[model samples]
Target: MKLPIYLDYNATTPVDKQVLDCLLPFFSENFGNAASRSHLYGWTAQEAVETARQQVADLIGAETKEIVFTSGATESNNLIIKGLFESSFPLKRHIITAETEHKAVLDVCKHLEKLGAEVSYLKPDNVGNITLEQVQKATREDTFLITVMFANNEIGTIQPIQAIGAWAKEKNICFHTDATQALGKISVNVNEMNIDALSLSGHKLYAPKGVGALYLKKKSPATHLMAQMDGGKHERGFRSGTLNVAGIVGLGKACELARNSLLFENQKLSVLRDKLEQGILQNVSNTQVNGNPTNRLPNLTNISFGGVDGENLLMSFRDIAVSSGSACTSASVEPSYVLKSIGLSDELAYASIRFSLGKYTTEAEIDFTIKYVREVVEALR
Candidate 1:
């Protein structure tokens, strides 16, 4: 095992070697503008892009035509929220989301709120899971979109996305989920979940950064999203930009690998996560795991240690890379709102750390983290 262990897979994952190998040729020899249709290079590039699109689509049980590539999940979230809002502005002006959503979705919701859109942010239950009852009660005649995340990045809590999607379907409302954290960790089928649009990030699933996909159901009521960018009408005119061929290839290969290995990988991760969590809780006094004990991503655990500042705890473990909360909000001195939303006290929130395991995380690393974290907490307390 490496000295500086990485337990922050929810933030980003290192590109898989196979994915990297698939990406290298696209950067030089096979490089061509995907949009250019007048030459052989362009044809090859476009063909590669389409093939990658199919790979991404297949991972989520979406049709190839439904996949719209973007720079990353953040862009996908923006395109879904803003594009949907812009398409039906002044009419379907209400949106519903959960408070535990990543900042990408929350920030976009905030921006839309400033534009005369009514937004409802549902607070999670004590276990970091939102009740469907809350969403149903929050819905109104003007509510056209319900956006939520499939999993909580900080807590590893899985939401009932399929139930929410069913409700949305019955009400004729579009449902969008930020599946960035859930995609590779869980089995995500857009059709099974009844999701109208879904966002996934490449970096979250062992793919290269700066690549992601938005699954926009073709024959759904949610297909009327307005174009967020205007260039050469790329990505079926929904998002307009040159395709990142290398990055797309990497993303595709990663998704294929994930689809093939998810079962065994998640089972292994579950054991490691449990071992780490149990060891910490047993040896470290005043420590508690956050979020629902079950119904969460298999590869991660979030824990709050009493009387120790999270930043200080993190600093003490320089060899163990973890996080207090979402990478997007790590700079803030404030405690994690996600933890607070789940009824954690302010001090506990500040004392919390998210340790997200991954496909490559080893049993030896987990044992080391358990021993080291317990030691640090004992000294700090």
Candidate 2:
């Protein structure tokens, strides 16, 4: 087994070997400017990009033309939120989202708030869930968009996306979800969920980094957004930039693999995750699990130890690579806002650890982590 077991799949995933193989040719042999419309090289690259777009669309139940590639989920979130805000500012500027959202969504909302957008940041329940009732209560006549995360990145709590999406659709409001952590870990069908726009990242699902896609629903009254990146007017004039063919190919292959293996992988990961969670709770004193116990990603468990410093616990785990919180906000000394929002005290929040499993995780690794975590917590106490 590897010495340092990686239980932080939420931070990012190692690119799958199959995805790597699919993308390698684009880096050299098949390298071409996808925008070069008059040459064979351009044609090949464009074909690969379109195929990737289809793969991405297939995973989310979106139309092929609805998939707009971006740098990653952050860019996708910015494009959708900022784009929508830019398109409808001063007319319908109210937006609704949750407090537990990823920084990508929260930060974009905050940025928009400075420019006359009224955003309602709803707080989640103790289990890290934002009920459809909360969203309904927060709605207003001017609410143009309701953007919430499909799942909590830190705690792995899945939200009521379908319920909220249906409400938004009924009210003629655009609904967007940052599904970076939820996609591939769970089933996400945009049409069934009534989602108008959704954001996803490649690295979150065993694809290369710096590649993601936004699913913008196409209908009679199309979801409109101003172009965030102004350039050659690519991606149907929504985003304009030279495409990352290799990363896009990798993302497409990863999505295809995830679609095929999601069920088996979820079953496998849930078992290992449960074993790890139960083992630690049984062996360690004063340990409490975070997030919705039943409605969360299958492969993740966040637990807070009662009497250990979070930093010390992390530093002691020499053979385990876990996370204290979201990788995006790990540099800050503040305890996870996600845990705190879910009603954990400061000490408990600080001592919390997130163990996120993945397809490559094995039973042996889970066993080792269980024992190692018990020993470390016991010794720290």
Candidate 3:
């Protein structure tokens, strides 16, 4: 077994061997600009990109043309929020989102607020869920979009996406979700969920970094947005940039694998995750699990240990990899905003740890982690 057992799959995942194999040829022998239409190389690259596009679309139940490639979820979020706001600035400026959304969504809303957009940030319930009623209350006559995350990255709380999507549809508003954490771990059908636009990142689901896709529904209230990037008008004029063929290929292959094995992988992960959570709780004193116990991602658990310093607890785990909060906000000394929003005090929030499993996780690793965590917490106290 590896010395340091990885329990930080929420931060990012290592590219799968199969995905890597599929993408490697694009970096060397098949290296070609996807835009160059006239040449054999360009045609080959374009064909590969199309194949990847189809793979991505298949995973999310979106049409081929609806998937727009981007650098990652951050860019996808930016393109959706900024593009929508830019296209309909003063007339429809209001957006409703949750307080526990990722920084990508929150920060974009903050930026838009400065540019005359009115955003209502709804607080979540104790279990890290923002109810459909909260969203309904936050909506306005001019509300053009309601963007929320499909799941909480820190606490592993799954939101009421279908409910929100249904409500948003009745209001003729664009409903978008940042499904970076939820995409491959759970089933996500855009049509069934009534989602108009959705963002996803490749690295979150065992694909190469620097590649992601935005799904913008074609009909049933087609989403119209201004292009964020100016050059060469790629991705159906929604995003403009030279395609990362290798990364895109990797992302596509990863999505295909995830689609094929999602149910089995999730079942395996859930069993291991529950064992880890139960073991730690049974062995360690004064520990409480965070997030919705039943409605969360099958592979993750967030727990707060009373009377242990967060930094000391994290530092003591020499042979285990875990996280206190979202990787994007780990540098900040402040306690997790997600935890705080869900009503955890500063001290409790600080001592919290997130253990996220993945396809590669094993029962042995879970056993090791449970024992290691108990020993560390006991020593710290």
- Please, what is the TM-score per model? 0.98, 0.98, 0.98
Candidate order (lDDT): 3, 2, 1
Per-candidate local distance difference test? 0.90, 0.91, 0.92
Extract clashing residue pairs from model 2.
Answer: none
RMSD of each: 1.3, 1.4, 1.3
lDDT of 3 by residue, 32-63 (tens): 99999999999999999999999999999999
lDDT of residue 116 for candidate 2: 95
- Alpha-carbon lDDT of model 1: 0.90
Between candidates 1 and 2, which one is better according to lDDT? 2
User: What TM-score does prediction 3 earn?
Assistant: 0.98
Over 4 Å off in model 3, which ranges?
A: 220-222, 326-332
Judged by whole-model lDDT over C-alpha atoms, candidate 2 comes out at: 0.91
Give the lowest summed-lDDT range of ten residues in model 2. Answer: 325-334
- Clash-forming residue pairs, model 1: none
**lDDT for position 78 in model 2:** 95
